[model samples]
Target: MTTPLTPHITTPITADLLRGALDLEQTAHGVLPHRLPARARAQCADGQLAMAESQPSGVRLVFRTRATAVELETLPTKRVYVGAPPRPDGVYDLLVDGRPAGSATVTGGSTLTVDMTTGTAEHRPGPPGTLRFTGLSAGVKDIEIWLPHNETTELVALRTDAPVGPVPDRGRKVWLHHGSSISQGSDAASPTTTWPALAASLAGVELINLGLGGGALLDPFTARALRDTPADLISLKIGINLVNTDLMRLRAFTPAVHGFLDTLREGHPTTPILVVSPILCPIHEDTPGPSAPDFSDLSDPGDPSDLSAGRLRFRAAGDPAERATGKLTLNVIRDELARLVEQRSADDPNLRHLDGRELYGEADFAELPLPDRLHPDAAAHRRIGERFAALAFTAGGAFAPEAA
Candidate 1:
């Protein structure tokens, strides 16, 4: 969509016009947003967290504009896996007056290709791409350009046919959510389609999603990040990352959970906090995790001769018997989390626990199985989001209007 460049205005993209990011740092080309502050990022030695935090899962450029045309210059980091099929282009979703208006994806940007066998990555830099949207609805309205959830993007410039300004406060409560890849929208169609984003829209709340892909390992820096961030509602989806990474044994996990909660409570003594357990993942239900990729056969058709189409899958690699020696499994994690919440709820009345299975369980699994054997697909994402809104933001829910 081409808009006349003459008489167009350019708006310098800044932190105040952004939402869902913890901090922003000016870069040589533009501004690089961070989901974790500098202090928390400084504590990280892991490369996965570094990549995840910079992805900006829930970040967006929000403003009020009457412009019928808008263009944004961005340099997005796209990921590629060696020996695997190409991934889809990252999507940028636009909303006008709180409804989806359009979507765009640029063809050219920087690429980071990873060789899984060698555990090595190669970066190929490219020029910035313009994400342009035209024919927007008329009248001054709140506009949101939701960033790609899985790609790291550096904002360069914002141009519009008409002037745009910071959106006025809407007085809606802000919800801060932290979790793993599934929460980071691994297979969801777009950024706004992520479960947390969907649920936030359903409940009419602002969102700050810290859903770090492969990085939600109960790090103290993460807890501290949550502690310092302002929020009216908070939720932590635990277990999947810990179980998959096989990070800690039961004894250590118990204290770590308590310590993480303690740190959050220091900053938000009475905030409504909801701790969620892992959802129904059959592979990790009884078996200890330490999950590994299975490139064997995802299209598991039982036919004798048709075996040409197969994709990457995942499976639990740890010994199930290890649970006797204090290893963690999804089922055990759920039980432990429930018990801990019950015990702690006696003193912290505002704290609550939600069984993740309630969001996606056996029956749903039978209907919509996880295509990758781990992360739920886009359809499942919608179901989980709807269930979350019903359970967490409705009448008897923690963040309900009446509850507040």
Candidate 2:
């Protein structure tokens, strides 16, 4: 439970206070319906507050900030629609600074109106999307937003004329996670129920999600991001994507993982970092993804021959041993991650490793087919969340509560 508190609200919206975007980041032409501009960040993780596990119930969350002005800008010029899909039916409590400003009900796929004439907006008859607030003070101290239930909230875009401060929530430990789409909640029911979101909720710890959808290619930029960020608890889920995407060769795959970890160690000298191998996705379990366009798409069954240059292809009758003998299989990734941890453990005890299959395996897949045959469904999210809570937040773990 969050502590109920009020924040100052005297400041007014100003030109210098707005903090989202100065110019439109990009045009939505040719992009998928649910896709957003590159500059637009998923709103689910902002202003996050996590408590220490075992802390007394009734934790308080207060965002003390003022707004100068808020702009609910639109794209496509004329009568435009910013579609927010996958939201549930509910009346949200939109707080300005700390008081109730307005309410918006989000209907998945419905376009919430962003009237250009008046900054006032209304919902599309379902659930709510982004709740834009404007005219905020330049020095708005704490701008608190709360969710009535554990439902997922997706904020599309916000431009405020205020300088938002650090989140007021406090915790001794921070949890960092890096992975592919499943970790990014692709095909999951909603943003908050994504396995990582579920896991974070149960553990009661701060989270910095680096789960990139279709973008976790073991790129150096990603490793540098993880290496530089500060954290108390960290976990990296690998393998499944490597197999599904066939993004790297065996020679390049192993060294990339090592380099990613080595760089992360530079910033977090003693932080506990856990590396998790991919969970079981039978489609690529025994087969290297064979460097093809995503075959997981049931609708298209993309061309196997055109996956891209230097990509590996999964053999239709691919077997685990055969897959391991060639490219980056789940088992192969697991072994590599374990070896990385073992080698690093010679000098660092804070680094840890977990097999993702332990959280969800072939059996779970029988009951719940990942919507895309890659990402988990809602029930699986719950299962993974509970398992992670038990493993990562137990006594002596980073988020464990203090002894009473």
Choose the strongest candidate by lDDT. 1
Q: How far out, in Å, is residue 222 in model 1?
A: 0.5
The TM-score, computed over Cα atoms with residue i paired to residue i, of candidate 2 is 0.60
Pairs clashing in candidate 1?
A: none
- Give candidate 2 regions above 4 Å deviation: 1-62, 65-169, 291-325, 396-404
TM-score of each: 0.95, 0.60
lDDT (tens digit, per residue) of candidate 1 on 280-309: 999999999898876444345652212233
> For every model in order, what is the number of clashing pairs?
0, 49
Q: For model 2, how many clashes? A: 49
- Candidate 1 worst ten-residue window by lDDT: 302-311
Worst 10 residues of 2 by lDDT: 49-58
